[model samples]
Target chain A: MTAAQGFRHGLRTAIVSVFALVLVGTYVSVGALAHDFGFSASWVAAQTVLIWAAPAQVIMITAMGAGASPLEVAIAVGLSAVRLMPMVVALLPILRTPRTRGWQLVITAHFTAASMWIEALRLAPDVPREARIGFANGLGVAFMSVAVASAVGGYFLAFSLPTALVAALLFLTPSSFLIGAIRNSRRMVDWLALAFGLALAPVLALGAVRLDLLWTGLVGGTAAYLVQRLRGGR
Target chain B: MSVLGDLWPYVVLVLVGFLPNEIWRWLGVVAAHRAGEQSEFLTWARAVATAVLAGVVAKIIFFAPGALASVPLAVRLAATVVAVIAYLLIRRSIFAGVLCGSIALVLGGLVLAP
Candidate 1:
């Protein structure tokens, strides 16, 4: 590549690093979580690669930690993922391009989680429609590679890391996540999502049953949307 | 071959867990073509995703094990809000906010530890 091409490539990578940090960090945390919970390494890697959502992953593992049955954990995790359908609908339009192959689309789609899609939506307007998908894939690829690497590392290193530090790192992704949400929320709906989820999580945590993550997403998300609508958020 | 035999069940279990997520991604590819910025579905997705992230944040902050748990809840919460707000204040830089937040979390833990 030419100097300019190289520089742009580097710049794109640099921008992705901002996002990839948490993604990779989350991988490490999840690795530790899975290992601590006695999950198989391959299972952890597959879900992190495929699922790409930490909360749902955490919920599944945590439920297991709480001795929930495999069927129960599966149901809880599946319910947590119901929200992704909307994310998929909202995000892919920006990335859809004629030249973009279906397989490529499938590969890149692995990276389309909530945070990535939300940011891409803001940037999609400035991008040509056809190239949007390419850009999204390019963005998504960085995280995929990182997740793969961190999973490998975390799976191996899970036994070495101290308990306290692992917990700290696990806590870090969400802190970084909240920071991302508060900063990136351009619309009123965005604000409501941030505040409502933040407020309702602890209450949901107190639930004796499983599915706290899903319940929080449902009740808190609806309330936030309602509150936003009441304030004329549309 | 032996290693493969040992790990086969895990491989399948992993497959089952990820299949649903892959469906979501393929669906994203289709939506990339059909949806628009102002689409109501987009708004709903954004709200749900953001809320989930927030809930995730709440869980990590309050419930995680180890040194972070040793810190006063008030201090940790305050530090998170301050760090995240500072991230926005610094022109929406994720790097800036996260770096500061991580620093604050570690430092706060050290100071608050008994």
Candidate 2:
């Protein structure tokens, strides 16, 4: 298929799947939380567009609400986004071709969030080499459009929404991330990493370390990798 | 000066939020170009990323920073447990799992609210 056809196919897949509604749920939560934190609707929308990672956006809102300086917030948000590096690394090989321009990959890289990475890793291999980039770009754009709209809607709706509902909305982000990570687990190391990360986070936080999340992942992930190695597994 | 003041938040959002996140993605593209797909490094990177994300998820669930913190800890744990169980039982239906978790949270908040 041509680039346009690939794009159309991606748009159809995103809309027809649970992706659009799930994003609506997640981004609406983000919008409402941004409102609660005194951020303007446009700020949240811009965040959804630029960051395009709900967890990092949520971390930014929470940090700013807690009066963290921009530098501090950047550290936290940056740590949260480290996952995107590896995700993009994994995804680019699927989408890249010999003729694929660096600029196109750069654009596609910007759209490489958890969900897009997941979808691309699963679907890009089936796409023609020339069309994979288009397909991934299409997926990213569709998700971004939905997310921005819902974030604005949620910001406006926060005033009328009940606290209980707001709490429920806020839970969606973490729940989805956890489930997605679990769903994508294929090896012993992957499962062990999730388990170890979960087990380590609260423990590390108790020490009040400046970068507890970073330590949790490093220690837990390294431990998991070692365990897999000792088990004679790849 | 006033315009700059008004724009500082956006600047912060881009600098602190967008740039921090976007830089890694760019690095990944370059790294992928150099290293190709499968490698020992890629596997370790994936594991590290997954762990870090899982750590973030654990932080959010256990020590939630915003609206979610209002719900009791038990409620949050229960909701998360329910989500995982539902996801596994429902053939890995993500929507069903999240929906069930949300329902449990709302219900727990309502029923347990004083």
Candidate 3:
């Protein structure tokens, strides 16, 4: 198959795989937010589209509902999203080509969240560089669509669905990430990072609720990196 | 109500929230241009990223807010183990792993419910 065809195929597979999982989590969470906050479905949908990150969206919605000021919500959400930096750094080189336009990269950057990043990182190696952006865009557009729909659906269904089902749906996004981490486990450093992150998260949470992720990430990751370095590098 | 008065706060929130996230991504693009994957900065950054993602997942599973808080710790851990096992058996298929984990959690909740 040609490079373009390979990219197209990969894109379709990613869209299907991500769509099946992403919606349930975002839908349920946004629905819960709407029910709790008395937010309109339209408002929730707009947030989903604009924020485009599930964890941050959840933080923003929940904090705002709890009567946090907009500035506070923004800071918390933005800090939560600091993880996206490494994702974008790792992904851009693979998708970019000398011939690739600046606007294309900007657009791709906007779409680079966890699910999309995972799929792109997995798929880009095989796809021709010229086609990588296209592949990412396909996954991004599909992901965004499902995200918006799920937010709206959850908003309505939050009132009607069984709590158990909604709870199950809430687990979907994290489950997907955990699975992705497992699938991408190639180096000892990766495993160390995961272990440290898991071990440190709860401890960090005791002190800092909103910034726990950032702290855990920095400390745990640096520890893992140092360990790998001390071991003569992986 | 004036549109600006009502919407400006949300607009500000969007900008404030977006800038922090986007700044990192934009910086990443620039760094990627200058540095190879083998660079120390990239390596450390990648490690940090994985840790952050892991931390988030751990938080969701163990210390989740709202409805998920009701799930027992044993069930959550069991579901994760089952999911990991499924991922390995399936040659690391993410879909299979997630499917097994979600099913395990739901089933655990059902069987273990009081």
Candidate 4:
């Protein structure tokens, strides 16, 4: 197929991907719940447009709700976003060509959340290089538009929904991520990292220390990496 | 209303929160220009990122704040296990896993509620 057709195909696949829809919907609920937690609706909307990463958005909202100072909230959100670095690193090459413009890369990079990254990594290779960015942008635009609308919808719904349903909505975000991580687990290191992180996160949180997520990630991740290296790679 | 008082903190959070995340994406663009995907640093970074993500997920499941805190630990754990099992059984379909896990959590809550 031609590059234009490939772009259209990628865009269509992304819009129809059930996993993408679920993740986007979960993010919308998260944004709405953040508003419910007392953050201004405008603030949540800005976060959706600007940060555009659901995990970081959730961390920021929860930290703010827990009375963390703005600096603390920022720190936690930043730490939560650390994981996206490798994702971006892994995805940029797949989406870029020798002639791809810098601005195009920048824009697409901004849209590279886990959902997009996973899709792009899987699908971009088959698409013509010239059209990869367009495909990604199409997916990004569609997902973000729906996600923003959902956030607004959830914001209105939050005021009317029962507490139990609201709580379940909140649970959807993390549970989805947990399942995503499990689904993404392919290598021995992936499993080890998850196990180590799962074991360490609660301990750190209960310790009442600052930057608990950051520390848990650093220690758990480093240990997993070392173990994998010691086990002689892969 | 004191607009500054109401807004400045969030503005600060946005700026600070955005930088750390964006910096990585920017770096990724640069690195993708220079290094092959198989570079050791990228591999290590991927491992670290995966672990960090897992840690965050763990925090949410085990030490969830607010309403989720009310659910029993056993229920949450059970739901997660079932979700993973469902994902595996369904050929790693994320939607199925999430749906199964969510239903499990709700059912677990109903059954285990006291």
Model 3 Cα lDDT, one tens digit per residue, B26-100:
776776666564677777877888899888888888886666666777887888888778988987777787788
Give the CA lDDT, 0 to 100, for residue B3 in model 1.
100
Estimate TM-scores for all models. Answer: 0.80, 0.88, 0.90, 0.82
lDDT of 3 at A234: 74
Candidate with more favorable, higher DockQ: 2 or 3: 2
Error of 3 at A37 (Å): 1.3
What TM-score does chain A reach in every model? 0.74, 0.84, 0.88, 0.76
Best by DockQ: 2
Task: Please write out the lDDT profile of model 1 over residues A1-234, one tens digit for every residue.
Answer: 332343344337535656677766667767777888877787777767667776678777788778876677666666767667656665665556556577766655676775566556656556556556556665665566677678767877866876446545655677766766776677787887788888788777876547676677777777777777788857
Give the poorly placed runs of model 3, Cα more than 4 Å off: A1-7, A207-210, B5-13
The number of the candidate with the highest lDDT is 2
lDDT of 1 at B79: 71
Q: What TM-score does chain A of model 2 get? A: 0.84
Clashing pairs in 3: A31-A154
Native contacts kept (model 4): 0.60
- Candidate 2 lands at a TM-score of 0.88
Once fitted onto the true fold, the runs of candidate 4 whose alpha carbons sit more than 4 angstroms away are: A1-7, A37-43, A58-76, A125-130, B1-21, B31-33
Candidate 4 clashing pairs, residues 3+ apart or interchain: none
The DockQ of each candidate is 0.55, 0.65, 0.61, 0.54
